[model samples]
Each structure stands twice: as structure tokens, then as C-alpha cells.
Target: MFHNSGKLLFFLGKADRLRITVWLFSLTVITIAVPLAFGNLYPTQAERDVMAQTLSNPALTAMVGPVNFETYTIGTMTAHEMVLLTALVVGLMNILFVNRHTRVEEEEGLLELVRSLPTGKGANMMAVFLHILFINLLLVLLISVGLGVLGIESMGWNGSMLYGMVLGGSGIFFAGITAISAQLADNARTSFGIAFAVLMIAYLVRAVGDVSAETLSWFSPLHLSSQAEVYGANHWWTILPLFGVGILLFAVAGYMASLRDLDAGLLRSRAGKTTASSFLGTPTGLALRLQRTGIISWGIAMLLLGASYGSILGDLETFFEGNEILQQMLAGESSASFTEQFLSLLIVVIALIATIPALMSMLKLYKEEKSHRVDLLYAHPLSRFQFFASHLSIAAVQGLVMFLLAFAGLWMAGVAVMTEPFSFLTIVGAGMAYYPALLVMVGVTVLLIGFFPEKSGWVWAYLLYAFIVLYFGGLFEFPEWMEYLSPFGYVPELPNEDMTWLPLILLSMVALVMVTIGFRGYKRRDLQG
Candidate 1:
């Protein structure tokens, strides 16, 4: 019975339930392609020599890893840069894959049905664990052969082999963490929170330790990825700790699951709301109630993150103090105002930060529709169009409030940096200029949810959207036509460029069109299964 149960789990995964496995291959190729393209872009000896000779600042080393400046070339940057990004992609895959197999399946009743049959306590989990192991193995071979084929075989085979082990270990460790979280939480939502809490802790420990040059990073999974500094001083033994902790967690999770009753979580959830929310009486009220907690949490966190980032502005010069080119690069024209440069960076960051709320707002459409909560709303007086618009209204307005809080946070921090309160409004205005772009993004998610209600969900669209903003717009400097494809691109480069209302109005119009079409589709279709 246990043997067939395990085999059934394997077959289910092979059936392409989420088409999630394909995402792994796609991500691996993209990771390889980014470095491969850059490596080819600068192949000249002198060009490589200049990069190899560039002095490493602590901030730069902390951001990218410690460079072997003498031997460091574009190839090294490619690998080092990928270390962090690759870890992020791999970690995301780990969490989502595990959660999908365990927690989300239980939430949706799939796990309960499977478990009713004769099976081992952690059959599904064993399948998930082994599935990820196979993926990680595939990744190791892919990246190693990929670099070797691309003619960038500059690192020791042993070091490169260790690099692959570290990458696989990183993902597997997070998967084990997710498995532990699945046992603790009663539902997928709580499980996600538990897992994400671990991720946040990992980053905070790693980032703070790196920023302060402390030993705290020794405890974080994120640190293990970049701490080796990849191309420089590759520690071959880091894989052992990651693998050991991950295996320990996996064993503990299986033991806990075996001890628990079927369909029951280790953490018991109790009914709440002895009294009712005032807004619980109406669909709009209920929607607001459902959304307000998320909005408030996001707003405050963004404000705090913005404040933290803003507080660090005056420190950038210190980071680049001895590097004249870097200083000039950041300061931009000794003649240009230093205050403006700092303000520009803050405003841009806060503006991009605002999109997160907008993305969450977009995602709510799926949560409500998929959960059949929207059906409850439709049972009332509201039309489908009205219902969809109501959700859209909350999202759009929430985006405005999110940016406002971000601006307020930046304003509060800017007073210390600007040494005057006058520039607060100036900075806020620049940040606010991003609203049109934010609105358009909100609309895109709404439109997708309205039409392709069953595809990959909001995460895929947001992933693509976010990558373009983070890399293409920020790092690659794409052309205007290409940049305009991103909702963020429609935004004026605040403080760096002057404001224009034409683009804003145009974007607003597009958003209006998207919302109209989205509602039309929602009104025509039945509620999701």
C-alpha cells in the first residue's frame, strides 16, 4: 500500500498539476542566459582587464560578493550576480512547490482524499522532497555544463561543483522549512505566513550581518549563497551544514505528521469574531474587512522599509568615499546637486515600492473568485460589473494610500537628510507621479484575473512584470517603446526627469479601458469552479 501510494504521488506530479516543474527549467535557462549574454558583450582583453582591475568597495563587495579583483572578469560578475538572484528564484520555487503539494492541497481537500487511502504518514511530502531533489540535480548539471559550454570555465571544477551543491542545498533547505511550516499551520494562508517569516528572518540576519560586518550571517540560508563569494574563495564544506539542517527538519516534519490525526494540523485554529465587523453586513464592507488587514500591514511595512532605506542615503557617499568613479557615478556631475541625487534615488525606490500594494490588490481578485466569496457577493444586490469594480476601487485606492505612506516615510527621513522640511513635498510629489503606472498595473492583474481565471494565477504575471522593472528598466536601460510595456515604465523618472501629465492621462485612460473590459468579461462568465 505504501509503495503504490508513493508511486501514485510520483505519477500525480508527473501529470503536470501546476505545470510548475516547467518553471524550474525556464528559470535555469534564464539564469544561464543573463551571464552568457553579458559575457559575450565584453570579450575584449582590455575590457575584461578594466573590470578585473576595478577596486572593490565593502558596499560593492557586500552587494555582489568579495571579488578576486585580479582575476575577476565579466564572467565572475555573471556568476556572483546570479548567486543572489538564483537563490531567490530557487527559494521561491522551493516554498511554492512544497506548499502546493502539502498545505494548499490540504486546504483544497486533495491531501485529505489522498491520505484516506492506505499510505505512510508523509507520503506526499516524500514525493515532494524527492521531486525537488531531482530538480536540484538537474540544475547542478545544467549550470555546470552550461558554463563549460559557454567557454567561461574560469573557476576550479571542485569550486564550481561546490557552487552547484550550495544552490541545490539552498532550495532543499527552504523546502524542508516549508514542510515544517505545513505541519504547524491549519491552512495554506497561515502556512505561507510561517514560511515567509522564516524567509524574512533569513534575509534580515544575512543583510544586517553583511552591512555591519558581523557574524550573524553564519545563521542565515541567504548568507550561505553569497557568503562564499562564488568566484572568490569558494568554501567546499558549506553544503554540509545546509544539507544537515534540511534533513533534520524533514525528519522532524515527517515525525510530527505521523503523530497528528488525518486532516488535522499540529497548530489548532479556533473560531474567532464573537462579535462581527460593522462592514460584514455588505459585500463592499466585507471586502474592505477582508482587505484592510493586508493593506495596513503592507502600508506600515513599506513605510518602515522606506524610512530604513531613506535613513541610509547619507551613507552611500561613505560607501563610495574612496572610489572616485563610483562617487561620480552616484553623485552624477559634481556640478549637479548632491541633495537632488539622493532625493532621486529615494523617490524612485518609494515609487517602485508602491507597486507592491498594487500587486497585492490585483491578486485579491483571484483569492475572492477562487474561494467563491465573490459568489456570496453576487447573491446580494450587486451586479457582477459592480462587484468587480468595487474590488478594483479598493485596489486602486489602496495603491494611492500605499504610496502616500511611502512618501510620508521618505518625507520624515528626508528632513534629516535635506536638513529642511521644504523638500518633503517635493520628494512626495515626485513619488506620487508614479500613480498612473501603479493604476495601470492594478488594472492588468484585474484584466487577467477576469479573463484567464484558470491559468498560472497572479504570481506569473507579477513575476514577469517585476523582473522587467528591476532589471530591464533599472539595470538595462531599455528603449522607450520597450520600457513603455511595463506599467512602471509609464511613470516619470521622478526628480531625475521632469513631470508630464500627458503620459499620466494616457495611462489612466488605458486603465479605464482595462477595467471596463474586465468587468464585461466577469459579468458574462459564471463564477469560477
Candidate 2:
């Protein structure tokens, strides 16, 4: 059953080496950097205690798991603030990694080609398992050593090791979930949908459990990792359930894979209508239909995310009152309230996130083109301009709607929680100020899909870079020019700083030029498939 599994594992590693490296490096850097920063930010025990007390509110407990304020050292603060959030991100990474290798490869026919050779039936699945295991192991080693090397008083070697193990355990648990999802769904899209849905459910369960019911939190893998309590109690035993359940799920997936035929799944796709509606025949209608599920899902998620952030706004004044580090970050703005400054920061991050679905909407055209589906549409009278414009228009409009939903959610929730809420119009204006930056992102997507179709993935990489620079630049004291590298940097931080029209206008014009050039390239270039 495992014939040539070693060779297949090496092949898989070679194929994904770059992606794996980037994820590992990013996660490791963030994990280590946070503790180092915390040490400098809260040098005195008094500041740490104040921060801990401020974070003790129920809103934050729901967002990040409960804090261990008993000790309240740098390590404890790091664990309180970073562990649950980092675990959530690591779970996402594992889900995407597993789904990409398993279902995505199968959809692209790469697995079929492999099977035509002398490989055993179970060789490919075994290779996938080993690949994921290797990646998780490397992550564990990197984070543990990285933290230990920092030599912080509270973050000792043993506690660092426990922290890394918790992260690795959460990742493996999600990888197992995605593996099972791959076996159950026939296509990559359905497989990804199922896996992500499970991830969301886990997070919501954990959030609810943390706020109200301690026993219920035990059901969530995220909560299990939090239970480890690294740098505090350092409950090493809490990690057992994660690994145990993860391996069990992997075994169940392998067995299911062995029983099923190639290119098929346990859950069958439902049959479509025999006769299509007239609207489905048009380019705009077709694009909307293809992307409807993703748009709706992203919209709801953004709304909920905004609400989560909103829940904590009422406590920001207390959270930021005596924190020297945060005050330094916002030193330029003495006139604005701390909550407003924090709101500006939150809007930037949220806008960056809202860009994902917008970009995906446009990139779907490239995906379809690669699959040769676009060739059929071209066989009819549809013009390149019409097809391109349809997707571009949908992306632009959806981006705006997503931003609004998030802002609306934030405003509604903030009003409910705050004794004296800020103006609704102020929040709306602040959010709308970032819309031009969002357009620039959509324009960049168009530029990529138009000319460098094969390298469309670069947009995501650029987005990641933009996020790091825009979100962390101030905190890290990066050079001024670094902020200009991202579109979000050009726009004024709203409600805190007065709105300026020149930069926003310039951004919009830049987007217009990029879109125009992209359309021209699309018209000239040959179709991919």
C-alpha cells in the first residue's frame, strides 16, 4: 500500500518547497517577534499588570481566549494575546496546504498522471501524510528554538517548547480535518468549502466556550491548545487530545480513500437544471453565478469579524490609557482619542482583508481560462472586453459592499456595547475613505490577470507584504517610504487625521490606468488553454 511513498513524498516537497518555506518563515517570525516586542513594551511589572487587567474584559476573552492574569509576566502576556490567534492562523495554513495537495492536485489531473506509473494505490496518500507531518515538525522546531534563543526571563526553554507544540498540534488537527474533507467532496472548491466551514465552526465554538462555558471549550481544538497555558502552568498534557484526535482523523481519511474509486468522493454533486435561465447566458450574469457562493461566504465572515473587533472597542480607553508603547505609536495624533486611533488601525487591517474576496472574484477568470472553460465562451460571440469588464465590475462592487458590511457590523456592535458611542456617520466616513485603496488592489489584480496570467499568484504575495508594512510599520518604526509601497498608505488615517482629496484622487487615477492597460493586454494575448 505504501510502495514508492518515499519518492512521492520527495516530489511533493520539491513542488511546494517555496510555499512551505514562506508560511513557516512568516509564522515563526511573528511568533518570536511578539514576545520580544512585549518585553520591551512592558518593561515594568506595573504596566504588564495594567494591561492584563484591561484585557480581562469579556469581549477580549471571546476574541482571544481567557488571560492568565495571576502571574502577568511577559511570557504570560504573549500567551494570552498571541496563542489563540496564532493557532487560528496556523489551522488555516494547514487546511489550505492539505486541500491544495490532495483535492486541488486531483482536480488538476496531476494525481492521475502519478497513478499511471508504478506507484501503489496508497502511496500518494501516504506521501501527503508524511509531507504535512514534516512541515509541522519543522514549524515546531523553528518556533521552540526561536523563542528559547530570545532569552526572555519568563519565556524559558520548557515553556517555549510547549508553545510550539501547541501550535503544531492545532495545525495537525486541521490538516486531518482537511484530509477527511478532501475524501468527502468531489472537487477542490467543495473540499475547500467544507474544510473552511469546519474551521469557522471550531472558532465560533471556542469563542462561545471561552466567554461562558469552560467545559464546552474542551470540544474545540483551538481551546485545547489554549489550555496548554504555556509560560504559566505550562500544561504540556493539554496537547495530547489534539495530536490523538488528529491522527485518528487522518487514519479515517486514509481508510476512506482506499475504499473509494479515483476521481470520485463519498458525497456526490447534485444535478443541475436541465434547462438554463436566460440570465445565465450573459457574461455578467455568468460571472455572478460562478462567484455567488464565495461572495456570500466572505460577506458574512467579514460582518462577524467586524463585530468581534467592535465588541472590544468599549474597553480601548482603559486598554490604552497608560501604555507607553501604544502612545508612542500614536504620538503624532495627540488631538484624537485613543479609541479613534485604534479604529483607524482596525479599518486598515479590515480593508486589507476585504481585498481577498475582491481579488478572488477577478482571479476566477484566470482560473476558468486555465481550465479551458473560457475557450467555450469565446467560441460564441462574447467579446474579450465584455468578459473582462463583467468580472472587473463585479469585483469592484463586491469590494465596496464587503467594506460596508464590515463597517456596519462594527458600528452596530460598538453602539450596543459602548455607554457613549461615536457617531455612525463618522464611522461610515472613515470606512469610505479607504475605498480608493481597495480599488487600487482590484486594479493590481486586473494588471496581473491581464499580462502575467501564469504569475497571478504574485498578487497574494504582494498583498501579504502590504499587510506587514502597513499594519506593523509604525509599531516597528520602519522608514517613511516603506508605507508608500502599499495603496493603503496613501490614504489619510480617517477621523483622526483630516481627509485629503489629492492622494485619494491620485490613487484612483493610478487604478484607472492599470485597468486600461490590463484590458488592452487581455485583448491582445492568446487564451491560456
RMSD of each: 4.1, 1.8
Candidate with top lDDT is 2
Candidate 1 error regions (>4 Å): 1-8, 11-22, 33-76, 116-119, 291-293, 315-353, 373-386, 410-422, 456-459, 462-466, 473-479
Off by over 4 Å in 2: 328-332
Q: Pairs clashing in candidate 1?
A: none
List, residue by residue over 110-143, the lDDT tens digit for candidate 1.
7777777776656776777777677677777776
Angstrom error of the Cα, residue 320, model 2: value is 2.2
lDDT of each: 0.67, 0.86
Q: Compared with the true structure, what per-residue lDDT tens digits does model 2 show for residues 424-492?
A: 888877888888888888888888888999888778878888888877776667798988999988888
Please give the lDDT score at residue 317 for candidate 2: 80
